[model samples]
Target chain A: MSKEFFTIGALLYKDYDLIDVNATLRLLGSLKDNFNIITITQTGEHVKSYTPQVANYINYNFENCPDFDILFIPGGIGTKYELENPVFLDFIKERAPRVKYVLTVCTGSGLVAKTGLLDGKKATTNKQFWDWMTSNGPNVLWVKKARWVVDGKFYTSSGVSAGMDMALGFISDVFGREAADEIAITAEYEWHDNPHWDPFAERIFGKNI
Target chain B: MSKEFFTIGALLYKDYDLIDVNATLRLLGSLKDNFNIITITQTGEHVKSYTPQVANYINYNFENCPDFDILFIPGGIGTKYELENPVFLDFIKERAPRVKYVLTVCTGSGLVAKTGLLDGKKATTNKQFWDWMTSNGPNVLWVKKARWVVDGKFYTSSGVSAGMDMALGFISDVFGREAADEIAITAEYEWHDNPHWDPFAERIFGKNI
Candidate 1:
């Protein structure tokens, strides 16, 4: 209702990779004037991360989430477990169509794929856990040689640190290249702008799919 | 004292930059088998970050802090306020000399410089806030062209995300380049092994110092 800043719903769960989650948050939050992020979870209670860092509280729960322009899902070791959760899958099923953009980092793409949202889309997941991640979405056109993949409204990135690069890319798409460049410059990050500049994929898989 | 993993005391306070703090934690935590991290704060209370993310609890207070091999300090807008706090400065002054390594990310280097440990020692800080960050330590040799700077046991990085690079550099120095490379490969990160590859310094200042 308030057209102030673009609202982003950052979904968090137990054992979520803290780096992937926080890197995306920090980059998006840096553009606070252009974006307002709310940490969302299945429950509003404390969420513990794979790093064992505990967040005292989350902003919203699944039952009472607000309307958001974008949905940000980050991956962790927990993704293997979360993918099998019916409630989590249902939440993605319900919300994926509502949001204008769907952004997934690391194996978070695997969770999105499980909802069948990424079935016909070009997406990517963390290269480190290539086999486990790729095994989930048989119908998805998985990009093996990408730092990130962009297909329509979906943006999926490679791994833990790659999420920052994808967030910058999303910023460039939504705002402008200049805005994204400024954010990266401010953070002192070398934005690997080329989506296909993924050496990890080649190193691990021996080829870029 | 356990000779197993290197112990790092991660200093925390209100409004500390979540990106800087978490990036360092996630990278270091990935090597948990080789490093034991404890979040230290002024009080044992939950410290809220600039992102408003609350850390559930802190490990130790300043007075009761244990001996650590390395001291980790992160920076945020809170750095502007924390710089003037005598207790914070005193804590740094006391612990810095005792620790084998002092790691400062973003404006955290400015805090370290304030304690005079970095006086006459070469270091760096967040490049976006270059002037203000460098203004504090007149005697410190500041490297304007660096993703991260290493002078003796002190490792200081450029900005929020540059901390990740510095952490990898630290990992390389401590555990060997192979170990750092393995960690980077595992996280699927392009480890910018060369510290001088700082495009931000050149873009912002028109030259690398």
Candidate 2:
């Protein structure tokens, strides 16, 4: 039997690039077979893809969204616009309780944090705008030194690739270390004992210290 | 003046799932200003946001695409079919010479290898198919231990998130380490100084030693 999963992207249609956005979708979809994943968008349009599976689009117009075992919110520059939209925030707030996992990549955490669900919860963002993220959602424990953070029901990653780690991390948490290990092995990831830090970073930042 | 940069995806039809594809594209687009990136599809269709960028949708079916400074190809199950197409192989061979860089994510490396570009070069792929990757492309050094591998002009990364690393790695190679460092810092990734390797692989197959 295949496990069911859904990943919702908060695409606001502002100057966002297509590479990273598409990258996140592809990585999450890698979980297919074991998990049936679909895309959620706010514009209520059918997403066209050269590959149709990647085009399985869902519209979120403040009224309907399929029940997702895992609700993912990927970030973009438009996240700034999303943060201020109450309808989107309200939609997230309503669904927050139903999902087994609440995940965010890059600045997507900022949008969910705005819903007040992450208040007092440890979270993270792209780090380029940590100050802005903290100011936007002051109630959560903002972890600065992290590639991704896991606190209770919320799993937030630092930036683009971190989202993949967050997805793998969630799979590990729910299915067991073996599943995560297989995925990582298949993906050729080093599988950081801790996804939070690495020596290359120390080489770069250690200098400042 | 803004730098003239663009990203291209091998838009194979009817395979990839929207969740991972769109999320990756969206997040990558958010990095446009940083990379000075614009994106065009294989059919010469420019992509705008999560939708196609070109209006005419002229479908300029070039025998081989015109030159660009950077070219990126993403993989899905469809890549297996793509591997058998000689036209795609010729197309990659024709366009590769003119581009400043060639990059791929996941199994998309199969396409790159099919072009014979990485025959004797060091490379990697989605972990599950490392053996197939090695068999398909002879003399290709299997850096089975790396999440991503950079062999001179040819750069290949392990499945999924490794693409993010490849993108950032390509940016660093072209723009300089400083630019890559800034991007890594902004993204909050440590730059996995050592490519991701499974510690157990060495021990599990100790006889190879």
Candidate 3:
């Protein structure tokens, strides 16, 4: 059988901080040879931006994102709003079985928790909001100290900036460490250096008592 | 004769906030039909996680950026550090004359102002840092109230997220408002609701006070 490689679907909605949405889109776009990716908004519109090769975007209702090799969820300030929606959660639960990979970044892990996908599974989110995830899904093993975490098919990552690290890790899993390393080198990012607790965060929040 | 189009360059750095970079990339990427989009990075190596399809990523050197139709500078914490480099400023001064369209967002505008490119031009930066911008670029006409400002070939925007709005406006200038609107609509960005402020500056900061 053919490898049947395919595009990744990034589900988006209102208050979906355009930065995270676009970051994932651009990262996935860079890996075009290995994965076809597009952004699907709540209105079922395939959003197009500066990328023309990505002109023919595929749009879908939040609850109707199509079957794809990977389902990516980027986090933002409005993540709490998504967790409160049963329609969105139900769709996530329904599609969990079809996607080979389920990825969540920043507060996006909360959505997976709402779907019960992370029950008794290891996960992570913005350290500032870990309590919210813990409160919503008590059974999940919350790794607050991690930049990214993996449990079964579910992959979760810390805050907005860490999304790139999580995505690179996913790309590493799918394509190999070398490919991931290549991308990190191109961006001048320390491929594996993830200081989960930023010094600024510690300064602002006061290092865990 | 084909319409004179310019390639806009955005510098992508490691650990840079993914979303901020994406907002600008998406807008520039979408305008490829009318503009050539080139991304210059401090590293020519592989960039994992975020948007990594930088047309030409250079490594640790200011000399690698190509002469473009336009120069786009997106802001983030990266700007905080990049702005401190004198070599980078020299590179900007050397290239500013070759390109007619010079644009920046958030702290990135500070770097532009530092190069004295916007010395006499009207511009803006993140609202929280308006005073800092004025202090840094004493001669520039700092418009603390505008979301995005266009003065001659110099364009600057306020804050990180606002880069997309500036990019859309820039696209409209080159591709017509209709094409820009179509791209925004497909992206589901509400097309008309920009989260930038100009009048708010006068009200909040008191234009004269």
User: Using TM-score as the measure, which candidate wins?
Assistant: 1
> In model 2, where do residues sit more than 4 Å from their true spots?
A1-28, A45-64, A120-122, A141-152, A193-209, B1-67, B117-127, B139-152, B193-209
TM-score of each: 0.91, 0.72, 0.51
Query: Candidate 1 lDDT, tens digit per residue, A80-150?
Result: 78888999889888988998899999999999988888998899999888888888888999988999999
CA shift of A127, model 3, Å: 34
Against the true structure, what is every candidate's RMSD? 2.9, 6.3, 15.0
For candidate 2, give the lDDT. Answer: 0.58
Show where candidate 1 strays beyond 4 Å: A1-4, A52-57, A207-209, B1-4, B44-47, B52-67
Summarize candidate 1's per-residue lDDT along B8-113 as a digit string, tens digits.
Answer: 8888888888889887777877775777777888877667777635343466898888899889999888898889998998999988889888999999999988
DockQ for all candidate structures vs. native: 0.53, 0.23, 0.12
Output the lDDT of residue A82, model 2.
Answer: 66
Q: lDDT of each prediction vs. the true structure?
A: 0.83, 0.58, 0.63
Alpha-carbon interface RMSD for all candidates, in angstroms: 2.7, 8.9, 11.5
State in Å the error of residue A22, model 1: 0.9
lDDT tens digits, residue span B40-141, model 3: 665543233223322112223355655677776766555667677776677677777888788887777887888777787788877656676667788998
Q: lDDT tens string, model 3, A18-88? A: 44555545554446466766456666653332243222123467656556777878776557777888877
Highest DockQ: give the candidate number. Answer: 1
The list of candidate 3 runs beyond 4 A from truth reads A1-20, A23-209, B43-61, B192-209
The fraction of reference interface contacts (C-alpha pairs within 8 A across chains A and B) present in each candidate is 0.59, 0.27, 0.25
Error of 3 at A151 (Å): 20
Write model 2 residue lDDT over B2-108, tens digit each, in one string.
36455443343334322223433433343445333323344553332222211111122443434456555665555676678776667778777877666666676
- Against the true structure, candidate 3 has what lDDT? 0.63
